[model samples]
Target: MLKPLPDTVKGPAMRLQHMVMTFRSALVDRLVAHDPALSRVRMGARVTLSILISIAALIAFHFLVTPLPSISYALAIVLSIEGGVAVRDRTPGEQLKTRLIGCAASLFCISLAALLEGYRLVADLAFLGVILAASLARVYGQRGFAVGMFAFISYFMGAYLKPTFAELPLAALGPLFAVTIGHLVRTFLFPEDWRRDLRAALKAMQGRVMDILVRLSVLSKEGRVTENDRTELRHMEEQLKDVVLMAEGLLPRQVDGTAHSDDDPVTALSMAIFDLHLSAESAIVQSLETPPPFVLVHAVISGDRDLAEKVAASTAVEKGGETARASAQALLWLQRSLQALGRAAGKEAGGLASIDDRVVDEPPTKPDFSWKNPLVRAAAQITIAAGIAMIFGLFLSRERWFWAVLTAFLTFNNTKSRGDAAIRAMQRSVGTALGIIIGLAAATLLAGHTVSTVILASACVFLAFYFLQVSYALLSFFVTIVLCLVYGLIGQLTLDVLLLRVEETMIGAVAGTFVAFVVFPASTRSNVDLALARWYDALGQLLDAARDGESRYRVIELSSRLDAAYRELTVAARPLGSAWSLVTRPGPIRQTLAMFLATSYWARIFAHDFAEAKKPLDPDVLTAIEEARAALSKAAARGSDCFATRKPRPVMAGNAAPAFRQGAAMGADRVANLLNRLYPA
Candidate 1:
């Protein structure tokens, strides 16, 4: 045996070891958490790499083969970025095809813009025509959108630069080179693999579930759950929802080329995870007098299956009141869910399946081109906004008018309503202002250091793409910094240039928001009402299927649709519950949002419990469920707001018999209370 160390040395060594272990644990947790930020970061890296490689190739060609203009270099950088993003989520072959189409569109637009540059009136008309065509092209889906965007960007570049016909051939090489490099980088460097992504997502979900369980255990030990605890649980629930959606989205792709049985292991695992989440949420909300078995909870946390099963078995024999029994049942469900998770984690597990297989065969609806159609209206609104922006931008700076038009187009790109457009405009304006400030500082510091400026610009490009989905403000900030650095590279960096950008952005954002509000405006209220109606319709279908004892697969299909509808409703209601809405009308929106959330909670619980219920419901309970279903059907037909002013209806007779199962009984009562809240007398 080794000799004992000195006390002082031993103490420091142990402390250092503990620190290392803590750091390792935290790192492991972070890697396993599957935070969406990581995915964005990876995407940013890929795009930045593609840009760098394209630029490098352009430089090499200019030095060795033929002299290329500076405009070619700029075009290469922009096209590389665009091509990388456009090809995301496509197979290698599809990616190549998409790149080719984008390249062709870019070339055609650039050549056309160059040819028309001498005739000012004709060029302006062509610009407007391009905008209209691009807006309409979105109807064809992602591929169309990509091609349209590339064409628009190329036309804008040509119009702004006013390149001569002689320069067209050399400049044409930029897009071709960019597309080739981008395709190679995406296919080899950062190719998408849904199967791998699904596995990672599942692991992240497991980590998230464990985190929730740990937090619940801590809350249970405290003897009572506080409002803060409930709020935290709700936040965690949102995060869990994101992870579940990510996993579900990937499953269909994962199973596409593989053979799968009707009873897919991945589907079963997903159901188990969802059921466990519901059960855990119920335990917390119920605030049972007795907590779940401490030993079982610990065992599950520690991955001690033998210990967990032993504790679960023991808990079945020791129970007290209804709350105690409910707690025990929840623990049992948790155990089963853990087992299913383990099976999925095994390497021998089969491929995943779509959340609802029936949805796959359904034909897509034809696009509506009428005035009342949302897409048509959106296209018209954006085109109008672009026109207004163009007029104002010309007054600001004739050369930079395209910036304002770009901002206006982007403002309405993904917005659903006037409120959303306003919010997006605010975000963009704020982001641009902050970006200018920071970009000014960064550009000044790296003024004469070409390499440093290039490195910083590359970092900004990465960060801009990384936060593309996370925050519009952050994306705009980094993009502005990249622009500032670009200007610095060209020896045009100035406070005046930065300020002009800010002005153009503000003009564009304002124009977009104004048009959204004044033109065929899509109201947030209408969107929310429609979303709620669809959700209620889906919920009614699920409840009807469960009550009628439909096949398990049928019930699962309905439940999946309900889940999808609920997600859509949550997205649609975001503007109503946003900070903007709170600032304008806090009281009514808050109250309505509260009612919506409460109803969602109970509705989910009822769906989960009733679907899993083994025995037929009591006759009186069945009658109550039927009444609730009918009411929901009506709510779907009319609107959720219709129930707001209506008197509450009793779900059951005063002398009705009790429900057969305690869980189902509690769920029914909670749902009844939710309806009462929705339609208070």
Candidate 2:
């Protein structure tokens, strides 16, 4: 008889179970945290397209070959191709690289699986399980690599398991047809012209500068831009970046042999956009100077010719007079370049005239590149995965081991923490178990009727399609259940056969998942900590630039800090179980660090606004600047301490200013809004 669980043992087991559950919940929360904007829509579309094509291809495969052994191989090829590259809004050529890398890595994984049959204790079933588990662990923290490896292993498993040569072809062909159809659908829906939107975005960036100039003029004259205006400008800048990335995604890669085709308008437009971007950089470098070229343009727009002329003649940026003439020349060249590009592309140009043409020699400072550490970890994970797969195949039956190995490889990505991997393992185990049970039940209920079997298959299709977008695990559940039942219907459906299939599936899934969790656990704490450290560094830079009156550096620094903080915060938020629990959860000090980083950025922006208010050297303005500087110093110190303590800190207040002078005050408020969202306290 089985002994009852001891209270002492049960308590720890239950806690383990609780921790696993909460961890899974956390990851799901983070995945949906970024308001699901374009990503959500794209994922939905992709899943729907994939499922639709998979169904149609399966039907064709059933009719085309009498005893298909080529099917699995074909499916593997298609899935591998699909997995190879993912094009984002930034770089289409990058997609080609991803595809090449993914394919090569997958092929290597498959070869390793084939070689694993030599290992002790890894013979037959266990070998496959170990191989798959190891491959999946490698991809736990990354995206495309895992998927590519999954397709490769899964295809090999299906191909090896076939008793008949005909069945082997059928398995490969089914998936291959599915992916080909999906690719065709995607090509038809998102055409190249979507890239034209990038050119429009570039034009809009110029317009934003002009718009900011107008606001600055009003604020300088009356003292401060409104909070709403600042927020809108920030939003516009974000949109501009998004659009640029999107266009870049649509452009053909040099590898595709279509990078700059004769008919491509995007290439020329992209070139022009890059030039204007340089101009924007130049304008930012001049932002610290009183009566800078942009300021002169603003003054002219406001009907202050005297102020404009006076400001135009002065030639210093950051250091004073030696660089003044160069800065003016740079501004003038920027104006001409903007007009030329705008006229060539039929796009509107703004803020270009304010740039001094001769200022081209001043190079902008570059931001730090600490974001690349995660990639090194990802590479190591993949190498380990290949080794594990080879060892497992050595111990298990080559055929059965393939199935187990493939299942393991799909379990996690390169960036996932060990806790996150544990959560995923549990989900995979449960989902697979349930699918097998349901598959057996469906086979029994619909016994021996062709129409009923077909109907059951169709129902499975609908459910898989419906839930695939919601969650991949759930999608896998239906896909597995339906596949088992349908395969049974075609192969001599019997109660014994159905039960055996279910049992085998559960055995494979569990073995695969367990190995993945145990082999090499991922750790989120370290990654989050690293991100927080970078954020602090960025925060320090922003504060230093503000103190030195380096407006361009401050703005550039602000963007980098925001992006890093958002990326890190997103990673932290996605893996937790409950939204409320994220704030209360212990061990993630990065969350607190992220909050303070945001606060520091806001305080610096406020100080910049206060400095801007002292135009033409009013003694009162310098006094105000000194006061804001002290406030900023305290805020930065508090931010640094909060990261060290992992404790929540109070947010600092904005600079004191009357309602009339609130024009530039709006810029400070916009930063404050972003900070509030980040820290909430």
Candidate 3:
């Protein structure tokens, strides 16, 4: 059993850890400092967009159909599916499946709604009923909600349109054809294949990392790796996280494309190379904080020829007690991976981009879900949503569909905070109002004529697609105008219709917001805390792995932990309160935590870098790292209170070599100086 540290030690340790986190957060903040222009450009202003060509085809449908009844029904189905898909970061297959589910469910629900019309009160309650059902459905996960949304939208629209059961077939077909065609286009004609494109990007990132590594080796040999190079390397290192995320996101779409086999010569070699690189990085960061062996540093500071012959070759070369033979074998593997990638790209182009070579048998875990009871909980949720919608429908306007829409939107994700939910609600309300205003204006201007309205509607559809990435608001604005204008052209723009839409939208938004706020709000703070815990856990794992020495599993596990921690940190930073503390409190707490976490990450890399430092000259570097860890541990125990006030104690020389001790001390001093400069008095 492990003994716990005393409060005095624990307090400082936590503080030191916190400080490290702060430093890393600050670095990230500098990199991604928010810009309104960038957000607008990135979001693509396309909120009003249906499944791109899905909406486009809908326009064509309006031109073909004389009455326009089927068009509205189809549009509603499109909207439901689009809304569901929008929330998820979907792979191509998933996206297609979601759309299909929405289409089918909507059709069935609407037909059922028509059948139930005889029960006038239940018929009037259709909209609100769906809302309740959808809200309850979402607790089951994205897939559940996806199916629910289709059913709810179809039922609500069919009931409101007062369509006969027979009309449901036509309503369904319109959306089905449009959606199927649109997905084919998205899958085939998009600028890149989702998985393939992402893999290509990952390969490019690997190349970049390799280039940085080569440069580092050369710089170490020449003693010329400057602060600028270090900074650039750090930036490049961060980008690897992005590439990994992209690869993960795309992998689900092209599972078959991932061809890396356990026995595949290239894959095994690539894995080894990755481990070595990480080891090198860990060593460098450790050296920055503690004195590393002179030989290890010397190998880096020496020229390329020396580095290639010494540190690089020694670290990467396989060990069978035959250094040259191992180095040759390792070199051959690296060459093969690079050559294979290049040849694959040249011959098959898109096929090379798909790198889902590794098979993962189990599906990834759902990120957030906490239920006291599973079946009971789900039933309770369904009861609440349906109950609320029924009460509203019965007591107020019988427009039950409003309840469903509200329930769907509010329950979209297990939110981290009420504030986030509030923000989304605000966006929805604003978007809806803006859309309504635009629609009304377009109707009034275009006048009540089918031919002219269809022409104008098509133009709006085109523009909406072009700008969907800009701003959801802008997209919604255009869509609202087009649809309303078309309704007006049909001579159906009575004050009643306009008033109903506004009322329904408002009702849905308000109800949804309330439900979201009332439901257990997931706080970003908790996630941050969890991430910090994981970071510490990762640090511990990395240390153990290093101590255990040369094992492929150990190395892979370390890298995986590092990747997971980085992702968690990134997520924490995105939400408020996670990283804003640094900005709000730029004192020692912030500064210290920032430095500590950054150092921790660097420390892990340094450990990796010293993989080849088993030679006699490597002892000095290893001693320095040990000394640095001790200092950090001491500082952490003190809660970062006197990081500036107190001086770090000198490392004790046990079996440490004299030259190594001297080099390690020098390295530690430089790092201390850097920390002092970064924090200031």
Candidate 4:
């Protein structure tokens, strides 16, 4: 018989059990997040096209024609793809064009690197030139990025093998055949339309926004909201909106037989929805962060029918007291946002204007070419890394030298941040090791079975493309297996070759990491101040707009600011978090960002309160507002100085106005708290 448990023991044990259960549930939820755009059926279709031709050749030839040729072509077809680089993107035609172009360019570069291999001076210059070309190709967008990658890989292989003149033609034909087959298979056989995916993303975002709005409506009725009532639902809404914009950017740009007309209007509608959601979030946050009145909440609920009806209903509530007036203004602002969203989805979708078109002939204009551009600087840095790595590769491992240079070029990925380069190099090293081991195992097990080799290669290619965005380690694993099979079919698999390849890759990875960290380190920490400044400026602009009674432009500015500030902070934080040093981390920047976001929430409410005023504020309150604004600005400046200098400064918490502690006083206190937290001792 079990004895009765003590109350103290039971209570804590039950609480611990509940926590473990909750954590387990959350873990499962997170595991299934980010659903794959392609269904298993669709993936199987892609797999069939990728390998069916090779299998047919094997069956028809019956060993008459060697499996090596078809295998090489199959490898090319599998690797050369738009989907191989990015995901859920609907630009098959564009990818085909860029990949094919890259294929041709790579063939030329590979041949050139081979012929000039003996001449160190000439070959080095050629390598530099091709690398530069690859770097600049990114100006053309994703297609160019693919081209750069393919070209770099080709050059690496050519330089590594140092093939004879007789071997060049065969080398060129393999990729040409693969590219032809890949395009045919992708274009005619298993065509993917991204419009459906885009619609799903848009609907998902809209649904989330509607849910948040509904929740806020219910909460508003309670009329006594605490700080905990403010949820991260707004942050989630922003993330969803970001996903929609990112998906839109990946849509097909060219007008061809495959392009759909309906996508244009729908694309516009998505952008409008994203834009209006920004304002809606700001307004709703103001109303809910500090509850206004039940009348305003009712106005929002009542106006949910249509734009006109909502606006008219909000106007009816404006005639009450000052509290009711502020609530009415917020209701009108939110309702107008909802109306614009409806218009965007309905008849006026095309008329919902934006600064840029969804699809354009030319790439968006960026800053003119300068060394200041991270790409240009990276080109210079990579050139040096390659040149130095080549020397080590030639002297230490002449036959496998290309692997080192390839690693150096591949490591950077033409992306910003040294931290990213370091991380990528590490991933590649780990992935390649696992991939090579598994690939060799598969080849050995399936030896002498040509059809088996083809089947496994095809499956590996399928899985590689599917998991490309999901994990670099997984991609590297599959890619290595496919290449190992192709090479094994050519009868080139040997212990010596395997060991040499591994050694060269390791060398390259170390060299690449060294270059990223030491020689030309562009620490994101240096840019932390600039990112903070951008956030501050955006918040200041929103406050000014609200104070000036320009709600439309104010909301627009707020939306743009939300996008810009968040993007900058994200860009800065990723690298900072991954930084090599313990001191140089994102913790500080994230802390500052959190405090700013919190302080700004109250500031937005304060702005709306003043903006909705029909008459001038009392002199006493006006004075209080001015003092509070100064304190907030001063806090921002101090935070900037502390980050730049890495020294603690005195913290100031703006004093609350004795008379209006719940209004301006409450907001001012938050600003002061932010200042203290932003640069704590």
Per-model TM-score on C-alpha atoms:
0.87, 0.49, 0.57, 0.64
Which ranking of candidates, highest TM-score first?
Answer: 1, 4, 3, 2
Tens digits of per-residue lDDT for model 3 on 591-680?
444454444444433443433244333555545545554544543343323323322322211111122233323343333333333323
Give the CA lDDT, 0 to 100, for residue 470 in model 3.
Answer: 39
Query: Model 4: which residue pairs collide?
Result: none
| Candidate scoring better on lDDT of 2 and 3 | 3
TM-score of candidate 1 relative to the true fold: 0.87
In lDDT terms, how accurate is model 1?
0.72
Give each prediction's root-mean-square deviation over alpha carbons: 5.3, 16.7, 15.3, 10.0
Q: For candidate 4, what is the lDDT? A: 0.59
Question: Could you give candidate 4's per-residue lDDT for residues 1-681 as a string of tens digits?
Answer: 223444555577786776677677766444323432343335545545645563454345445653343324433543444323422234566656765777777778767887897897888778778887777766656666677767766765666556667666656655565556556666677775455554445455555555565666666667665555554554655555565455444444444312333335543454465445545655555555444445444555455545434443555445555554544555566666666666655533233233232353553576335867766677777877777678777776766777778778778774456676777788888888988999889989988999889878888877776675566678677878887897888899987777777777777788877787777677555555567677767666654554454544243336345455746766565655555644464455455455555555555445434433435555544554556556558766753554433323322111111234555334544544554455446
In model 1, which residue pairs have backbone atoms overlapping below 3 Å? none
**CA lDDT, every model vs. true structure:** 0.72, 0.45, 0.48, 0.59
Error of 1 at 220 (Å): 3.2
Model 2's lDDT to the true fold? 0.45
Model 4 worst lDDT run, 10 consecutive residues? 649-658
Looking at candidate 1, the ten consecutive residues that score lowest on lDDT are: 648-657
